[model samples]
Target: MVSRRVRDIEYAIRDIAVIADQVKKKGKKVYHLNIGDPLKYDFKTPKFISEALASASHSGKNFYADSLGVYELREEISKFLKHKDNLDITSDNIVVTMGVTEAIYFLLAAMIEKGEELLIPGPTYPLYINNTKFYDGVPIEYELNEQDDWEPNLDDLRNKITDKTQAILICSPNNPTGVLFNEKKVKKIIDLAGEYNLPVLSDEIYDQITYERNYVSPASLSKDVPVIGMNGFSKAHLMTGWRLGYIYYHDPENKLLDLKEGIAKLARARLSASSIAQYAAIEIFKTKSNHTVEMVRKLRERRDYSYKRLRQIEGINCVNASGAFYLFPKLDLSGLKKWKNDKEFAIDLLKKTGVCSVYGSGFGKYGEDHIRLTFLPELSILEEVYNHIEDFVR
Candidate 1:
């Protein structure tokens, strides 16, 4: 029998991807705007990082290392966090996992019990939903206000709180929306967590993917409210395949010691994250690559281009994306003849024009009228895809 968990699980990001694959098998050229992988744009990983991994492997550093990641890499992570985010964190607080994906899983496993609830942002990355279900934890979604540049409706968050609420999750520079959380909003969330005695899990995978704003590290604002800082090299460093992610548990009150120990136990059970990847991760400190700046420049250009073209389409409304490479544009299908829902709109658009985009409803219930499109492809491809979408909508 399939497990109840399996029956309940759905990952809309990759789930929609299966249809894209089916389209490909029919010999149609699908312009993929589905996944957040930057390497798909023909962007090469930095040579120094690759060289470090090669050196580590050839020098027989392939064997399992420390369960909580190598002390060296952990130290570098601590310093990086301190320098970049100004967090009063150290190596002792860091735990390296396979990726931020695994870091989240480990953190969730440590915190949640069956039937408990996690307060998560709606139109979030789908992993939060699937993983919560995997452990039988209920997800209580708080909607982002579309009318307010996708900020969380704090009253909605206040209303959703229950005794079963275990933790609050925030994704700044949010997936799908690409809206960076303002300091006031984030500080307010932190304040709420403080009053409720709930820890906040901040997914900061796209911490570097911002423009015209400084990304706030949630942990930096609190010494009392425990903050679980989740980050990785996937989005920023173009190291998606490397699977290197780390978590820092910051609690001056020492409320999260048990949680940290639980994560360490899970880390030990998994044996260790890739030792070579850990080695490669440390070189990020040593190697300064101008490639990242250029990548961000290209990404900003693509974002502006996509936003401009998407707005020109008759029934589409997109808020200007301030960070990351995605645009969660609302599909105003009321005027359109062919579609009633975002899923049908996205799938039919793919089938008709070979442009692959994810139905925003997959992100959460709040996203039904929207579609998530990645701007990871170059400008020419984004322009072409937008052209096809404009034609399809007509």
Candidate 2:
């Protein structure tokens, strides 16, 4: 027995990608608007990042270092958190992982017991739900009301809590939606979790990519409650292929010592995440260059233009994405006589318009009529995509 539920789920977006591949084989320049990978969208690693990696590659520190990450890197991360999120994170609380994906997976594996539940937001990232199932933990999803600008429904959240709710995952500047959590909402969720004595696993990989409001770490709101703040350099530093990420546990009183030790053990068992990647990450962490800032500025510009363009389109309605590189637009397939669902719409669009976007149905239950488009493409391409989509929808 593999001790895993191998057949329970299939990442459907990747499945759709198979069809997309056929389109690519046909020599139709398919606009890849599906994945959130910033590097694929003309983003280059900042000069500081390259310089840091170059220095490390030349350095004789070719061997593996501490499992908790390099001492200097952890220290720099602590300083960065203190300055950026106003949290008093120390090096002791930080555990470097391959990426935020590994950090989340590790944490879920360590903390989740059989039959326990993780409260995930609907129309959210798929990994949270998948990981929950992989651990034999139930994923109890609460829908994020799109009509409410895609904020977490507090009533639904409060009602969803039970004795078995081990943790609640919050992805601010959330994927698909790009809705940044406000201080009030964060406080409420923290308070509710505190009441139930549950942990909050915060995925903040897109923190630095915000356009309108500032990204707030849940750990900053309360030192009293335990918060596992997961972040990595993949998105912000344009180092997705580097596979470097880390997690910070702000337990305040060493409440997570046992769990942290287990995570460290798991890290060791994996023989430590890519040593070269970690070395390169340490350098990226130390620099305050214009690379990430410039990327954020460009993404914001794209977000504004895309929102305007999509809104102008007669049948497409998109939420104003405040962060991240995606815009989830609800297509009015009601008028289209052929397609009945977003999947068919996506297939038809790829076949007709050569615009590839993953259907929103893959984003859990609530995203039936939607499609996720990464605005990471250049302005001209976006303009062209809008023109194509407009013509197709009309």
C-alpha RMSD of each candidate structure in angstroms: 1.0, 1.7
- Model 2, TM vs. native: 0.96
27-89 per-residue lDDT for model 1 (tens digits): 999998988899988677888888988999998999898999999999999888889988878
| Distance from true location, Cα of 333 in model 2, Å | 3.5
Going through the candidates in the order shown, the clash numbers are 0, 0
Global lDDT of each candidate? 0.89, 0.84
TM-scores for all predictions: 0.98, 0.96
The alpha-carbon lDDT assigned to residue 79 of candidate 1 equals: 85
Q: Which candidate is the best by lDDT?
A: 1
Q: Which consecutive 10 residues in model 1 have the weakest lDDT in total?
A: 286-295
Which candidate gets the maximum TM-score versus the true structure?
A: 1
- C-alpha RMSD of candidate 1: 1.0
Candidate 2 least-lDDT 10 residues: 280-289
Return the clash pairs for model 2, or none.
none
Candidate 2 structure quality by residue, lDDT tens digits, 97-187: 8899899889989988999989988887888878888999998888788888888898999999998998888998888788887779888
